[model samples]
Target: MTVDRGVDVRDDSGFTLMELLVAMMLIGGVLLGLAAVQTSALVTTAQTRQRTLGTAVTNQVMEELRALPWNTLNKGLHASFASAAGGDPNVDGARLRPPVEPMIDEVLVTSTTQATDKAPLSGSGGTNVTATSNPEAPGIVFTSRSYVTRPAAGGESLALTVITTWRANQTADERHVLMRSTAYAPSGGCGDPNNQPYLGACQALFSASAGGTAPQTTITAAFGGETTDPEVDATTPILPGTDITVATMRGGQTGVGVTAQQSTAVESSALHAAGSLTAAGAPSASASTGGEAVENQASNDVGSEGAAPTDPSPVTSNGVAGSLAIDGGDLRMVITPGSGSQAKVSASTVTKCTAALPAGVPCAASDLASAVASTTTLSVGATNLQLVRVASSSITGWGARFAGVAGVAATGCSTVSGPGCVAAGASRSVGAVQLGSASWSGGAASSGLIQVTSYSDSTRVERGLSQRTAAPVTARSGSLRYWNGSAYTTVSITGSTSVTASTGTVTWTGGGYTVRATGQVAVTPVTDLASAPDPAGCTGEGCSISTETGTVSLSVHYRVEGPSGVSAFVTTTTLGAARAAAGFKAAPGA
Candidate 1:
């Protein structure tokens, strides 16, 4: 029964081709949207990167222009622009070039046109625009214009404009970025090669006014509406015609002529009287002119090399009458009041030093004091350090010499800690007196020699004295008599001695002898009257005696005779006579 059920089996279900196509289309559409988003993100990132590079390039160019010679700038010439190209291996996007190159972006310079009144439509109409070619690089255009401004306080100004433009990728969209900048240069003269070409013929205009003639013009162009005379009015904004012809007269005059207005009621002759016909056919002067010429004359008058006017006080910025102070020639020092009424120095404060003092050194004490007292930064001049005292607890080399002086001393001073005095330190030399007591350590001699005088007694001798510690010592012996309150004591010796002291001379013989003193009276059995005191005991006559048979210790009693007198006695007996010579005496009762 199961085998017979498969008899009518056939395929009935299947996917339609249109449905598959629709699914694929949906997938493709989603992929396309993602691609568009990726492309936009990439474009935005590239633009941001390009903008950063552009800023860097701008800075680099500005620095280069600042360093370029004025004459090079004056020539209205520059290096050629170079462009670079590259591509990614994967996407093959647009190529990128170094932005520093002038051609990194296309630049166009357009000089604004000068309008005039000759043809009412001439100046009012866009005209007088000029373009020149770069002589060095023919392919490049020198679109920047050179225009001269009217006289300024110091001099005239010449302006130049630099313009740059960049284009986006062609396939993506039509878009552009443009930047323009104008700069004015200043200098004393244009002839200096390093400073020349700051501005072209504009610089010469100042010299021309000062009696110098203008050079002949090489380039010239004439506009159809340009007339010899042009009308000037409050409403005229620019000169007539896009291009105006300019001529240079041989006699140093520059005249401009424009075609007179044909249907205008205002006559062309009135243009000259109205001060409207300028060389460029533009307005001759600014409208807000208020005593400016008078002010310039006053400045010139004040700068003139002569005594200023006694009266007619000059008006200052605050509308106050300004007065000038007269300076007394070289002898007087000028004083200026600083912040908070502190004493300060001004340009006029210098005084000429003429004569020198005989003895004392003259220092600018006031100047030094002022510098240290200033609330602002203390600017130290040579005079500011004139009276600075250097001091230290210790020093080396020449500073030590100054430290040994009698009165003067070095003070320790530093940039940070200010200054300090070392009063305890001695000095080698003072104002007039030289110190005689300075000595060196380790037995070395001081910078100065030792000084001595016999006016002091011999007892006042001094030995080694240390300069560092200022103390007397005995290591090196030398005679010195320093000031004492009382009379000097003599340190002298009478005997053989290395160092002298007050005493008798020390006598020594080749062979030693024993000295002895006998009794004043000898013991005699019932001694006769003939017995007497031994003269040997006459110690009062300056003698000493020893008693031992071999080597004996001698007892020397130095009987110093009193200031009054001295006496001695002896016996007449023979034995007594022998003993009397030995310097001993008998007992008192005997």
Candidate 2:
């Protein structure tokens, strides 16, 4: 019997049961959407990572394969590095994908020779093995193998392909990446010196005369290779060219000089010739792009003849030994450096810089022909030894190493190259250097066949009628002068006739005088070679590594034989890392 209020009051505080249920459903739905988005993002990130890894693995391995020797590009005897392939990286410096390379672990490597995507011409099928890639891609695995297209008849051009395959844990689809290249066998796979990759320094070398006092010279460019002996036919011409005509030696039957002590030694060359010597200035080096290969050019060289220092313990043999001239000479195993045309050194022993270097840096191997006389410290000393890479893919340098006076304070240290170093001796510097096409050949029982050639465009002697008397008396009986690296050599001429000299042919007609000089070494391809004479070696497993030195040479050319697209020359790779594995594997890629 409470007093009746104006109206009955009611409280509507919280939400209704149905309202709460609807709100809870909305919140749960929002949370679920956020979780789904996060999951999708994570998956996308993982896929991206896998793609990136696959690309890296493909590229790195492709690069490694690209460095293989031309003949070494063939399929392996087995699907493993345990056995020697056609050519081995350790022996021939054929850089296939390194088994220990990062990101991808190879259980086995195989090569297949197929005209199409089918199996190999003759071989056991390739062994399948799971790949273990980087931990970053724990769920993915990669596998790789090489593909070589069967050469066309009479056209030994080979198409090379390095294919890499991969699959992820959750996906049914597999991805692939491939790298490809073409290789040509110059002489039916006998061997090609010019087709080699410069394993050390990318450069060309030529012999030069160290003329004058202590044979002072400044190198503007250089080339390097290993020297081995291989006997050749002594009576026939070894090479053909406009200037080369005869053989250097007239003794020794085929394969007569190969010795049991055949050993390989590093060959180092400074300049093509004294004529190629140029004073140091701004180096004119180059690097590679997508299409172009890498290169280097040196300049502003200053040097002089001097003694070898003791502290750095310079390399005494196979380099600028006292009186060994570093003149850029006109000689080479092949016309091209590394287009599978020729190979002087086994592997690309050196890889040069990405950009053009200044006056004082080293170049890369991709563009360089090679490096020689590699030593613990002497050839690559911190301050004493200075190397300059040339655009022609070689090295040009000057050494100021000089022995210290017995009692005086480094008497002979003054030179054009620079000053002396700590715990060093007196030295002399090279003042100038020149760059040009050049090469050199080693002498011995294992030397390869080479023809001495005389170049004419600028290296020899050639001039248009621009300076001669227009319609005047012919150059008949006119005197001629030519630069022989150190000085101008005057030569006698016969009137309106060609005179054959012991070394060359000199002609003087109504046109200017032409002096052609040539020399040659008649070498036979040795069957008892240290390395395999052919890429397919005797057993097709691989050539037995020579316990002695490996002898190799350039292909033989016969100028006297005439050009029928036929040559008597064959080349072989002889030296590099030589290793053996415990197990033997035999099978061509299928």
Candidate 3:
């Protein structure tokens, strides 16, 4: 034992008055280790949350760029396109406008004032400056810089890249994420022919190849941008935004517009109501997307959350109180490169391969080649879709007005009750007078245009105000019973819903939502009623269909999976008719 400062200490490691200080040092060291571990966890969590937000912001910026008229992305925004001298001088030397959203994340320390650097290139050979953004933030600001790659010498596409940077709070290191996208211009630029928004098809989804045998190596999941490793095909970036907007004007004319372009793609301005489309003056010119190195194919979905049940909605009026309004004007689908000598698709005898076509009816084809390889094809006008699908507890208004047979009222207005009368999903759907429901022949090839517009059974009906539920209680599923006069009958709508008495099961036997649109129990599958196939008025190659119309009011939702990548557009306009019976539901509280 050793004596030190009046206390006897046992071993050198043991504690005495002086040695006690050493023991305290050991505890302090352990605590420091623990604090370091805790700090690491907090840092990791913060980064993960910020990364998620950055990803969403990155995708949104790219989508906004794509949504604009394709031309603006090059000349209007980049300043390096169509100047004939390679780039515009007055503008910021061809660099893309950097994306900034103060509301999204931490505000940049130097927001109004910014520092400049050649936007970071995810790949090689990038040497352009003039674009500006906040590379540093006071706390955790996410600043993004963008760059646009004009199409290669024979290419018409425009590549967009966004690099989002954020400085980590713990470490002074700056973290970044890169995202990209591509877009095409519309056809028939009678106004700005050379400066059209899209030089190629707006929805091509591929990347430049490295002279390789296997091309999937450099493909992405959406319209072409930066080509990521194709092996991670499951991680394809999803382009965000609604589909395109097409509306018919007063003089039986239709137009589509993208506000970002600062111009209108008003197609079919002059359809020659008096005579032939080729007669005197028909706005001629269609953007032909024949050249494109299409991307790879994959088994993919747009992030499926399982199908949400269609909410209850009303089918409104066609504004025709009594007139047939059936003197349907002629809508010629003029395919620019069509064989004029051959019968126009509007007058062709093509097989009713409704199944293979947009219509889901099954048909057999004899000449698969002539059948698949048609003279005409579907243009952007025909392929755009406008959809709004959501499941909510709050609903207002109705789609169609229903009355009781033999003076009976449609008792379908019980909002929050038990299992509904109709089948599992929606069994009844009422639509306004539609001009685009035709059989397989080109005469009126209309189906699949408005594939699903339905509402479920368990919904209640209220006129002035929407109903509110205090809490969500499993949203009662399964068959139920309703009062059908004399005896309590398993609920059933005369033509739509039916129940098996022995088993409490409701089933939908009706032809689909669009079938019973107006006429009693009418289910002629809609192929292309509002729009036609070839705008130059030919039977579309059936690759897609255009929604042509003399006059009607409705919302359109168009989405397509092209070359493994997904792109969508949406437009809502009141046609010559009143507002569509589109129902709105207030989402439930968490």
Which runs of model 1 end up more than 4 angstroms from their true locations?
1-23, 46-62, 72-160, 166-433, 438-590
Best-to-worst order by lDDT is 2, 3, 1
Candidate 2 local lDDT, 139-255, one digit each (tens) = 578765554444334254555555566777655676666555665544422324235522221111101110001111121111111132223342222232212212110000000
Quote the positional error of residue 45 for candidate 1 in Å: 3.9
User: How close to the true structure is residue 72 of candidate 1, measured as C-alpha lDDT?
Assistant: 39
Each candidate: RMSD: 49.4, 29.7, 32.7
- What lDDT score goes with residue 576 in model 1? 8
Better of 1 and 3 by TM-score: 3
- How far is 50's C-alpha from truth in model 1 (Å)? 4.8
Which structure among the candidates has the greatest lDDT?
2
Tens-digit lDDT track of model 3 for 305-338: 4421122111111110110010111211211110
Q: In lDDT terms, how accurate is model 3? A: 0.25
What TM-score does model 1 achieve against the real structure?
Answer: 0.22
Compared with the true structure, what per-residue lDDT tens digits does model 1 show for residues 449-536? 1112111100000000111111111011112221121222222211111321121112111112111111111111110011112333
